[model samples]
Target chain A: MFRSRTRFRAYSLAASCLLLGVSSSALAGDAPSTIDPLNSPSWQYVQARYFDGQKLIFDDRIKVLAPTAAEDPLDVPIMVTSDGIADVEEVVVIADLNPIQKILAYQPKRASPDISFRFKVEQSTPVRAAMRTKDGVWHLGGTWLSAAGGGCTTPSGGSSGLWQGHLGEVNARIWPREDKNQRLRLRVIHPMDTGLAKGVPVFYIDQITLRDDSGAELATLQPFEPISENPVLSFDLKNVGPVHVEGHDIQGNTFTATIQP
Target chain B: MRNGVIGLATFVSVAAGAGDDYHLQPVPVGDSAQVFVGKTEGFARGNGGNIVNTGFIVGTDGVIVIDSGPSRAYGEQQRAAIEKQTALPIRQVFITHAHPDHFLGDQAYSGIAISALPKTIAAIRDHGEALSDNLYRLLGGWMLGTRLVPPDHAAQPGTVIVAGRKLRLIAAQGHTDADLMIFDEATRTLFAGDLVFFQRAPTTPNANIEQWLSTLDTIDQLDFQYLVPGHGPIVQDHAAIAQTRDYLRWLSTTLHNAATRGWDIQEVMQTPIPERFRSLSVLDQEFPRSVTHLYPDIELNVLPKQTAAKHE
Candidate 1:
């Protein structure tokens, strides 16, 4: 089993080299360059599948905050912030080696350039956040995080129906930022099981939609099982007046909440 | 020069917290033995779980250190502190268990013969990386350059002469599947390892309560003037063993009863702390974690019995 996995990884490496238009000899040379996300076949596939021919520029201005090693792989908190960039079109988060690599992509509507979210990390892998500017150039930033693995495969601690009573319970708080923007933080109770765990099957919240009091969709979120149990997300809200959140799980259970400021 | 600057910056970040600083001040136990009792603190980002107690016995020509602390820096400080009092070289380091706090520091004791049970060596080999990663997250920069060092010698259950002093290594299984208890024949001092935790609530994340209770009984039978536990203060009386035994019994009973009644884990966690255990260090923090670890097993055990009873 281990030998096959190693062989598969070697094949992927060779395939990645071929796809990135780089010779294998260049990869094995002295003074080898640092790992670039654009050179990764996974990132290339994400870009081709999501952005459709958009040019991505490596930018250090797009700051990302994540631990070099995660204590609990089930809930790895990450924050992505960009400065000196104008007219952001979308921000996409990719866990380069995850089974479902494209974790989240945010098309901000009247929101700030900063966002914080938590997701499950499968193993030691690179976590990338790419910001698409108004000119259609994708600026990418990422960091390598080391984990003990099995975050997605292991059974969640709440597997014994412990969360049944608290499912869909929502806690919403709004804090005013210094720049006159309000940060909307929402925590919903759900066990985002990844089905890889023994006997857990795939139970997770599949979608969440945020709307204003007038029923206008403010933003939509499509989350996967990799999101931590009792999912919490924070968004910088520009026009905040009695926001309502509606969500549905893979089991077809719908959850709704109202936040008044 | 740049590397030196980066190293200095890392050291400064790690040393910024006075509470997390690695300092071992040896206090005399019994007549000739000395012990360094670490603070009974919980695992945090700052402290890195440096809460286990370690001690040393000065023999005729050298010293035998019991249970290295939680990190490389801790073991280095411990070695320095031992050298401050005696000029004897550390001949052998005895690891009490496979827990990261007890064995991770083996990296600092370079060239010394580090010893542990065969199971402990296997555990260190299997789980050491995961444990190190966990410690890295907890200690951050404090765990700089710390790596897992496997034991060089197998500490079998027998007496071994170290520097003309007879040291008895006994295999005790309860607190962990394989625990080593060291006894100094010259001083009548027993290093009880994690088999005993005094004043502080004992952590049983990897314990078998019944086997641990039997091990406690075995420890009670040993002839010792002074007892050094894996955590908290030294023990002078046999009654101290009862504290850990009672807590284990209470925890097991609580978990079993809750499981039999089909109560939720949150409800079981809400089981009020006994008045006697309220003053134990880190009780509030560790009890819930212990419940989380042991309750699932209890539920599994009881669920099968319940089904059998219903069929009967």
Candidate 2:
């Protein structure tokens, strides 16, 4: 009996590690420094596949603020702020282990140096924000968040017709920033369902373009399924003007709204 | 790095005693009340987020358990502990709410009659599997062999005589859509489940703060000398209820203000927790969760009247 119990315990531990999808080495409590994104297999793949073998500098100047553990994996809030890094051109958000690892690639123009958004976290993984400065260097910072998994895989609790009447609806609000520049916040109603969710095939807004009333593209956002349901995006715009927001989902359903200054 | 080491240390310790390992220690709270004060801590694999307080009352004829606990193993251990104190059979198990920590342990008391409010029962039936899956991922080995077991008896808001003791079941909403507060007339002790969190931050993922605040007021007026909260230490006075009420009110107002100011969720997160709450355990963890749960509602409340009317 004792031997069988011991064997069962061993099997349980191994199965638990497999179920959690975390290697025993990762759970063995090594120093955080040892868990560098550059060394992680997913990050390495992302670097090579996305960055064309460019070197990423580990910089503390870029801060990624996320909860150590997500209370709601479906909408884990994340904030990325830079210490006024000069000539910062863009910020790329990545969930290293998500089925769709690339969440967003944001190009900030006259926007504040800080950006905050909510996204889905499939599991406990390292979330990183890589800031590309005008000098062509990628500064990377990240933190590990432990989650229960299934933000991407589980069927949402809402009824199937939840978005029938609300699809593509957009609400925009513009507020003055401290520097007198106006901040444009847009909220679009969409399921953003990842194909990974059981019983729910892939349905998501693929591309969003913010255009001036005169048809000039102000910004274009390529969002993946990992974007939270009812996607909300914020940008800092100088001298507000009437703008139009347009997007289409994977099913080719079109949505459009006009934002007036 | 420090946190990682600590986590590993806890895992090691838990693994060292893999068989028949149970950490709950029950202490007497009142003349007849005994509470198993769980580790006053946050969710971690080591503790399995079994941070809830489960209690029982031993009367003339039998014993009545307050909450079932977090897992099958926990419930089994709790049963064993209670047996050590009394010879009376566990007549019935009262589940305070539908949260996994409170009802998932029903499997351990298979032969015993398990009871909960109708809504709580429905919630457990509907969300139990999902909640168990989440807990299994979080607690790992501790949740091994745990399964969801729906309550067998539907408890209503009225007096039920168990073991010849008058037990008043009060229906409450806010902390959850269905929260039950059990008041024992015989002992003058109230088992305030998740409705009252003392010294620890209340988990608000399912809370309706407005309803919860009003529920607190109702609980405060109840006639009870001893109070057992779902997550924290036992209370002798009404101060604990006020503390919870204050926290909920402050949380609601803060979210409202942040929404009105058009603050991003990050800015709301950065808002300093009041000095009064700085001393509460798990504030760092539960505060952000509360914001995430309430911010969207707050934002909806602050939307331009015309825009909001249109969406509806």
Candidate 3:
């Protein structure tokens, strides 16, 4: 449970920019990409693909808690959350050395900026969470997870039922703490295949939506092949109610479940 | 790491003349039994896959073998060693379970009556090759010429007289889907298979901790004066059985608690062992593996309900 964190900073940057006679009122700017502590070879490419000319900071405000070594790379659980960064707009999960770099992206509309999910690790890689705040700056937090590799390429034949016949089976539960903190955990049965194995094509859950009883969006997830087979995801919600989960795999199969908190 | 398939042909040629390289010395257990205890460690080129115990019992008519060793070399030498003891023909060979250490040696005993529980046979048929390839990666030349050979017959659980010796075969699960424990009524000896590991961490890749614990109680009740674990030294009393049970209980509880707290695998693996379990051979190496095998389920089963259970 070793943690690395950075202090959320500089709301005064905007006020200070005015006195410095900057051209724009916006205070946020691209932090140096050289702050790569993990120093993954994929850093330059990852920055170009996701953050691309946007103001970014590879800071610790966005905290990513992951295992130091992936015991079962097929389902390595991770927790991503932010500290003082408020009004987050987007959260992107990535494993720099994995064959599939971008694992998933989450948009928590009415949910807290906290999520727990499992993902596949191809090898030793720096797993990261990039949170884009409302101020238009992308902040990244990452931890290194060493693996024996091949979690993505090898078809984990362990859960065949999740793929063959019951591709859309859903198991969901709403956990309501006495302190009014609500956590929703759901699992959708799918292979989440990366098309890396012989005779197996890319078949995976690509989009997931959590909505309230009135059908308003609670949060949305865009999952890639790096997600574990029979993907299970958990989220901390801003409010408690009956939540509906609807999911669609890349093969067009769908699954849905409703849970009361 | 290099792939194990390459240079395998060359390794096989070197192994033929080296069949007796295991130096398999069977120690006398009782009046009728000889146990070839293996090293209490992981599979490696130095040890081959000879990290598992195998033995044989001499009945009046013939010999009943407990298990085949890890490779063709171990199995071939094991039969040779038995041949040195008695002139009786080998009556039956029992594969304790489908784990590679217990069954991969079946090739050397071709034409012999090799038997196992139906599920064990199925598991060997299903995952045997993959498991063999795993050892090939570790031991390389030591695993030369080793091939997957599934059991020839399905063993029924009951009292059966093999080679004029009354044997009780108990079918159980927990260590794996199908584990067979053989009790020799004549000598009051029990071959516990991998179901019991004394002074060594239990492997849990195919274990259900709760079910395994329950099965241990069943084993404790067996009226055997001598116990032979699939690994580690033989015991005269229930000390080895109790050690295995105590270790498994602590392992399950630790993992359950860790998962309930949402601790990632590294945190769980880094957990310190108690003073009691420190005596277990290779606990540092094997404990991490057990955590890897069982922690995923712990997270799935405990993560959601535990918070509510603790705070409510």
Best by lDDT: 3
- Mind giving the per-residue lDDT tens digits that candidate 2 earns over A72-93? 8888888887887877677788
Instruction: Considering the two chains of model 3, state its CAPRI-style docking category.
Output: incorrect
Q: Over the stretch B13-83, how does candidate 3's per-residue lDDT look in tens digits?
A: 47644543888888988799889999998776778778899999999999999899888878998999999
Off by over 4 Å in 1: A1-150, A153-261, B1-20, B45-48, B305-312
TM-score of chain A of 1: 0.79
Inter-residue clash pairs, candidate 1: none
Better of 2 and 3 by DockQ: 2
Candidate numbers sorted by DockQ from highest down: 2, 3, 1
lDDT of 1 at A2: 45
> lDDT (0-100) at residue B176 of candidate 3?
97
Which regions of candidate 2 fall more than 4 Å away from where they truly are?
A1-38, A53-56, A156-159, A211-217, A241-243, B1-14, B18-20, B304-312
DockQ of all candidate complexes: 0.02, 0.16, 0.09
Rank candidates, TM-score, best first.
2, 3, 1
Tens-place lDDT per residue, model 1, A204-235, is 88888878778887777777778878776777
The lDDT ranking, best first, is 3, 2, 1
Writing each residue's lDDT as its tens digit, candidate 3 over A184-218 gives 77766677888886677888888999898899998
